[model samples]
Target: MLLQETAGSDETLSLMQLDLDDFKPVNDTLGHPAGDKLLQFAARRIQDCLTSDDRAYRLAGDEFTVISRGSGHPAKAHRLAEALVAAFKKPFTIDGIAVFVGTSIGISTAPPDGTNPEQLMKASDLALYAAKQDGRGRAKAFDAAMLELLEQRELLRRSLRMALDQQQFFVEYQPLAEGSRIVGFEALLRWHHPLLGKIPPAAFIPMAEADGMMPDIGAWVLEQACREAMKWPENYIVAVNVSAAEFLTSGLTDRISQTLDLVGLPPERLELEITESVLLERTVNNIDTLNTLNVLGIRISLDDFGTEYSSLSYLKTFPFDTIKIDKYFITDLETDPKSQTIVRCVVNLAHGLDMQVTAEGVETPAQAEWLHSVGCDRLQGYLVSRPLPVEAIGEFIDRAETSVSHALV
Candidate 1:
């Protein structure tokens, strides 16, 4: 009705859609009652930010919508969105607990954007998705580009369902080396779309996680990697990256155990690599799951170390077999004294904790020599070799082993 009225009137109106960021952790950590109070507080704060002509409504589950009428429709809508984001920045005290939350908003002006409710809401929703994708606590206005991206994403989502069935996804193995010797291989997921050529993991992995397709995809990768590793030297291990969604999926441990048994790969020969984000919520369950895998003789690695602020705290909480220093710190290690200092400190710290350190993105001989000199346990990246197809692994391993033996001689 509001959109219809605006369409008939000479004046224009804007619709703004908003979603609260990091709200799920609140519900998971705090009781839902507390979450309710937080939501109420957020609603009041949002209403407070709006002008007299604007109205706010709770759409569903931390999602909100606002209708703004009068002059400068979208401009006023953008201002309201910014104000709302700023409003949430201040902490809300729920039951004497200080809780922090942020919001992402999308805006679409009527007539120019749409004359009907469905079109305007969809435009605003698309804008909202863009805001969230840009890292939350921001606002995005409806644009043709966003619409095109949305269409592309939808097509990709549909294609992803058929991808695994059609065997379009495959795993590539990147060597992880200890000094001159190759210690193991890290399995990297790759996708080759029939029509889209090759799609980067960054483009589709998040979409899979969002659509709840990661568990199946992750399971397939695990089985394939384990089977391939069975063909490698008995002492060599295979490390597979696990997404947070896959890590938290129920029966994940059992699935892995079954896969290892079916593939006739020893649990000790498989390593599961996960980022700090996987332990962000459900810490107890995640710890139990990790412990179960550990009991099965599987190694758990903390990947992309130092990327998150809470990396140190996580180390204290969980006993990770290895920590892979992020590539960001390695890019300028030779030239940057700070990078050298940080890498050295991380290597020392990991060793002190009885955890091995793997330096990723080791692209040059100098970097590898420096990492070796600093007592880094493993090196992975272009310096060792780019990720390889399964058929290439045997030849690469033989060459690497021969090179290591010659160096030792």
Candidate 2:
């Protein structure tokens, strides 16, 4: 069986050259079944790209390899792989469900690279790994450094598997205010790794998504934060961060609803904060999931508004009730006159849409004054108070209450 795959040609040696070079994302968002169908479709499309003699194989999870023989222009082979990837660039309509999948590919040749199936595939995989590292939905030829990086990435992926389950993570709630009154808390996920003091979300969130652990990790975050908030004053609300992955994951909306029910927390007390990137050109299911959440009476805040290229078109489409001006604008409003103007414009625009605007990262008195003067409805920052643990925050609020009562007396 293996021998037939390794004996093809200089350009297309059986089992030696890697065809269907792209690595498909096996997102936990899409769930296992959709992932399975996409993987099969990838294998079929790759096989169809080559000769009848070629065969495709699944390495694991979302990885696949195809064996084909040919001496065509390395460019020609890439062009064929490009065609397959292009087909995938369009959203996949599977079982009446329209979704999207992206992949990266790598290629290799036989005899010189390897006559044996294992040796040939190793070279091709090294090249493919390089392609994916460069970014998904692209292709690359074999290289050595990329092989080493792949081994390192494998080690990183393994350590992250039990990260959330092991309790190595926690959330810090930043305060948001309507003038002097606290209105909500933005729940920010923090990973306090034992060996590494802190790992940036940028480093691990994408890694978790790649390793297929996002749904579990993300759901854990929702449950923990909701339970924590349920202990707070009834008027206080918690904003749980939502990633685009939630839409792809089948049971996420249901899981979240179940979680809220478990804690007996009102949906209005919980807010799901999502960035504009998640809503831009999203699949139908993803959009539907957001709509479902909106109907549940939970507040949805478009966090970090104006950071991306998503225009007013997307903004007008959703039922988001709040839009948080990104910290960058707030941090500069004190000195950068332009920033002050931008904040004013955004506040006006948000009010025009009937959406409340909250200014984030309000570090100093001057910035706060500017935001307030410009009609900003809310303020959140270090000046207000950095994020504290649940117990710490309770104590902090108690101290503030005593201070106010003393003044009243």
Candidate 2: Cα lDDT at 190: 81
What TM-score quantifies how close candidate 2 is to the native fold? 0.63
Candidate 1 lDDT tens digits, 301-355: 9999887544477888886899999999999999999999999999999999999
Global lDDT of each model? 0.89, 0.72
Runs in model 2 lying further than 4 Å from the true structure:
1-153, 400-409
Residue 322 of model 2, lDDT score: 88
Clash count per candidate: 0, 17
Model 2, position 305, has a per-residue lDDT of: 87
Measured by lDDT, the strongest candidate is 1
TM-score of every prediction relative to native: 0.86, 0.63
CA RMSD of each candidate after superposition: 3.4, 8.6
The candidate maximizing TM-score is 1
